[model samples]
Target chain A: MKSLNLQRVFARNTYLISFILLVIVLGINYIVQNNVFELRVLNNNLRTLLPLILLAVGQSIVVIGGGLDLSVGTLVSMLSALLVTWVTPDSTPDQILLAVVLVCAAGMLAGLVNGLVVAYLRLQPMITTYATSFIFSGIALLLLPRPGGSIPRDLSTFYRSPLLDIPLAFYAIALLLLFWSVLRTTRYAQYLYATGSSGAAAYATGVPVRVVRVTTYVWSGLFAALASLTLMLSTGGASQANIGDDMTLDSIVAVVLGGTRLSGGQGGIAGAIIGVMILRVIRNVIFFAAVPTWSQTLVNALIIIAALAGPGLIRLIRRSIGR
Target chain B: MNAQTLRRYLTPPLIALLLAIALFFAGGLINPDFINVTQAINIVRLAAFLGIISAGQTLVIISGGEGIDLSVGAVVTLAAILTFRITGGDNNLIGVGLLASLSAGFIVGLLNGIGIALLHIPPLVMTLGMTGVVSGTILVVTQGEMLGATPALMSTYIAKPLIFGIPGVILIWVALGVVMWLLMERTTYGKHLFAIGVNRTAARLSGVRVERAVIITYTLAGLLAALGGFMLLGFAQTVLLNLGDPYRFPSIAAVVVGGTMLTGGKGSYWGTMSGALVLTLIDSLLRAMGLAEAYQLIVFGGLLVLLIAVYGRELNLRQ
Candidate 1:
């Protein structure tokens, strides 16, 4: 009975597999690099992974709400471009803060555009976001025709530095989790899941499915803004038009690895966060394993494909065995 | 045909045709040199590559289940690289190169089919993952090196006019277009494809081999993408890393602009052909204007959104 109960609990927790995978990968990482858990190393690693972590969190919410945001990465790029262009190294702290607020607003506005088209206009989310990605990338290119910008060294130093021996990234992550927990308790969360699982059913039941869909994109945009800000600070404010282009797919991959259904309404931000960490650690393992430079991409891609196929393959095998 | 039936079949392609012509004249206005017949032939020649690749995309999209082939670009790159390696700029080995490239594409498509159709992986995820795998394979084989060239005869065929100021490549595209039209309109496979796309469960109940049809569609898409890559080698006259990368989104965009529902079950290759021409014209016009890559991206994306807004909206409220 106890074992059955445990099995049920495990089945109930969609992220359990992702969490286990993370633990295994972390262990491999530690074995490959003995000092991986050390404070400074841990902090540095998390710092680098944080931008993607934030992006994945946003992607998770969007996916959970029954939509996808291919434009999130470009939105990050555009925001980063806007940030670097707006705030110079010599700017006052007040100016930097104001720029950050404005950048966040722009990010939300971009999301609103995506949402309105998808929600009211009833366009497919994937294609809509895919189309809009080009616009964001174009804006990014226009803003930073060349990859050049400077943020104050002091700002980056502050971001890198620990307060009370805890990394700032940890605090940011904790705050994000806190925010999610709060949001999850609200009625909006219920509506989001309902809409995602079955929009028609949800609409019949009095849910404002369109509004919920629109809000999901708004949240995604806001998180993307945060991700862009984090990325800019990490890179010392040097901006590139294509800086965030690769992260879009990576974020989706991370979200999936976290056991979140791309079909929506079946996952959490925690799993997505863990998924990002697993991905990062897997890269670390590759680096420490000293795989040939030429074969690294091959190895990485093979591993990812295996991971993506694993769940389906397992189910197939189990069913065949039962037969 | 009655007006309703004619309108249903013709409206999308008509809009695309009108757009292409408007853009052509618009290009002439931007650059006086762009209005000539020579330039028009050049645009068609260039569009042929995109059209061929999008031919596969059209089949995949029409098969429904949110089908897409992101790996088309990677397959193109792989095929180009493979062709260069096989032919070594020798015309005598061109046939061998074509066979090898097409087989490689077939095998990749087969894998994609098995994953999506049998294993029940989502098409988007399956194809995206396949893209990574294919790209990784390319990197491994090439080791990041630039090597080999197109056969001299092939390059000439692609670059020079063959009959009535039309490049041989354009003729190939025209031939492929006709074959595609016949395949989609007259074959049992095409009927199955449409039925499956429109309603998978219903098709299955009605005795359609949904999996087999989907697998074939994806396989053909892969084959066509490889063909595009082979032609690209001729047009480019040399191999380049990620040669097909530029066509990935454009192929989908062409299919979408051609009035094919991304949701599946309604579209035509003729519409896709016109859509490809429109896209090529947009590129030419933008280039002629001397706009920066940034502005070009802006206009291209803006135009895609505007075009889709014009015709791609879902009629259902619960999307």
Candidate 2:
């Protein structure tokens, strides 16, 4: 009985379970590739994963707020296109910074459209976002019909640089966590959870459910822009109109693996971050395990499905045993 | 009928018809030749493909409880590839091709239903994962190069006009629509689906087998998707990796625009047919106006959002 109680506690904390899984995966990764934890290799991996990590954070917020953002991928594509087409290598640093601000603003505006349509119009979030994704991609294609542009080399190289023998990615992650931590303590976070858990109930209790939902999407949009920026820096400012379509599913998968329920309410950004790392590490493991190149996408998807179904399977077994 | 009841039954189909007429006039204005008999035939042909796909989507959505099929496009793609492979472009092997494609769809839907119903996975994640697996399987099988000529009979007889300038494919679509209408409007299964969609616990307590209904709904969706793919092969005369790509979002858009509730249980295949025609007419109008492909997509998305918002308002008011 006591053991079951402990199991219940652990089950209640998805973060704890994800951390343990992350540790196990990292240990296996180390065994497979001795240089797995070496700062140089680690930096390269983290840099590659930075875009998805950022995207997962935005997606986690949406899922926690009882919504989904299928448009994030297209939003990433649109912003990245804007960044590359406008922020030329010869442009002054101030111009580049202005471009960044502009892209972020565009993202928030796009997200605001989604938020208003969803909140005020009470449209289905899933289908509304799916429809809007096409618009975003269309704009992306119009912005950069053909992908050929460069951000400054100095800027790209700086994004790769390490601080104190740890990659800049570590610092960015720390900053993200800090931001989330601060946000968590605010009244908005409590309202977000309440609204997501039960919107009617939240409304009855005098929560600004519509405003809360809209703000969450705006935050999601801003983060999607940031993720696009990361992708731009890593890829040396190249842009593709369809680059972010696949990442939408990847972000949602990370959110789920991080323990956020798709139905909404009950997960944190920290777990989401860990989920992204776990996904990245699993990809690394797949590489070292010599999985055939053509089968990697298939294998990755299968693993995700397994991960998603794993907790439910365990619960089923435990319940049947108890019965 | 009273205004409320009449409005409930008539609003979606009426909206769809009005949208089609508006687009028709717009096409006539854009390119004087676009409203003629030839163009009208062409639009029906185009709408037929989408109509078949939406027939399945309409059912899935009507079953409710956040039911959706993200794997529709992927399933159609796989079905087309397998059918082509099985037939090897021979008219004589058509039976084999159809059987192979239909069975493939059935198995995929059965697996989806199992995961969603028995395993308790959310429908979105379940269908999303199914898309990956099915698409990945196609990739692995084709080794990134899948090419097959559609059978000659498919194009010459099935797709092209064979009877008094009416295409066989259009007839098939009409037949499908009638059958589906009958199934939904005149059957116990249809009643059960709506009941479950409206309230699963109530349906269960009232002796409806929710799980079975959901499973059957998904399986039927898979079969219809595969049928749509087979027709696409006939129309296009070839199968490519991305053939099913355009149909994915449009399938959902068509169903939603047809007046089916995104929340499910209150829609009709007839409404879906008109919705498909509206979208096809819009596409024709866009082409006639000489909009770039990018603008076409933008307009499509924007129009979908507008239509859904209008329908959403009506639903809210009724509630």
Winning candidate number (lDDT): 1
- Pairs with backbone N, CA or C atoms under 3 Å apart (clashes), candidate 2: none
TM-scores across all candidates?
0.96, 0.95
- Candidate 2: lDDT of B297? 77
TM-score of chain A of 1: 0.97
Cα-lDDT of candidate 2:
0.85
Which stretches of model 2 miss by more than 4 angstroms?
B1-9, B314-319
Candidate 2's DockQ is: 0.53
Task: Please give the distance, in angstroms, between residue A204's alpha carbon in candidate 2 and its true position after superposition.
Answer: 1.5
**Cα lDDT, all candidates:** 0.89, 0.85
DockQ scores for all the models shown? 0.63, 0.53
Candidate 1, residues B235-304, lDDT tens digits: the string is 8877777789999888998998888998899898988999899889988898899999988988888887
Please identify model 1 stretches exceeding 4 Å from their true place.
A1-11, B1-10
Superposed Cα RMSD, model 2: 2.2
Which model scores highest in TM-score?
Answer: 1
Q: Candidate 2 at B308: error in angstroms? A: 1.3
